[model samples]
Target: MNASRLTDHTGYWMRMVSNAVSQEFARKVAGQDVTVAEWSFMRALYDLEPVPPSVLAEKMGMTKGAISKLAERLLAKGLVVRTENKDDKRAHSLSLTNEGRDKIPVLAALADENDAEFFDTLTREEHETLNRILKILAERRGLDATPVD
Candidate 1:
């Protein structure tokens, strides 16, 4: 069977593109001292400020234990802080500290650069079309396209 035949399948193309783009993005972020998972968690925090670890786990599609570990690491790095929620002491809210807040924009800029590096060859129309299609898939799959902070 020819591979081109499978190219018409959305899952096949999505995985191929996602894997390639993410690997290159991981490389770009490596110089900044973060793994892809850390970057993702940070970015999520940026989208939703003062979110609890449980909320973060849901947003990241990660386990609470994993989120707790990452939160601890980020806290140690002074990038994020955890505080008891005034209304519920049992639930702690997380937010980016001055350091965490500052790093997000820089990382976001790097993301833009990475996208340009890979997709700059596409025409504006092509980019728009791709975005539109991808957004539809994201919506259908219930993917949280929103930033986590």
Candidate 2:
């Protein structure tokens, strides 16, 4: 029986880089009064306004409870609004408030900056290859959940 070293697995390295990238992005967004999870939720609603909570949950690959919690927070922050469904009074829809719409471009800029800060060291070809490989692995593994943490 042979034991493999920690460095023997590509997953270990991937996780290390992923953690660094996510943490820095989290920190950046924190200054903007939002979490990465909130940013994801806002980004999703940026173009698709007035979507149902259930639809958002499905698109984000999150549970309804999770989406509801985030929505509540955003609502309190005046970044999102909820309205009764016109067709179904029993259901409700969510959309970004004017403030949310304004903040999205700033948040998106932070995301772009975070990616550059970490991945700019890689050559263009290396970056493209890495993105391709990661996408393939994610698809193959059926890992569709948005990274909120």
For each candidate in the order shown, give its overall lDDT on alpha carbons: 0.84, 0.95
Candidate with maximal lDDT: 2
Query: Positional deviation of 104 in candidate 2, in angstroms?
Result: 0.7
Q: What would the TM-scores of all predictions be?
A: 0.80, 0.95
Task: Estimate, for each residue in 54-83, the C-alpha lDDT of model 1 and write its tens digit.
Answer: 898888787899899889888988888999
Clashes of each: 10, 0
Compose the digit string of candidate 2's lDDT tens values, residues 1-149: 99999999998998899999999999999999999999999999887889999999999899999999999999999999999977889999899999999999999999999999999999999999999999999999999988898
Q: Which ten residues in a row have the lowest lDDT in candidate 2?
A: 45-54
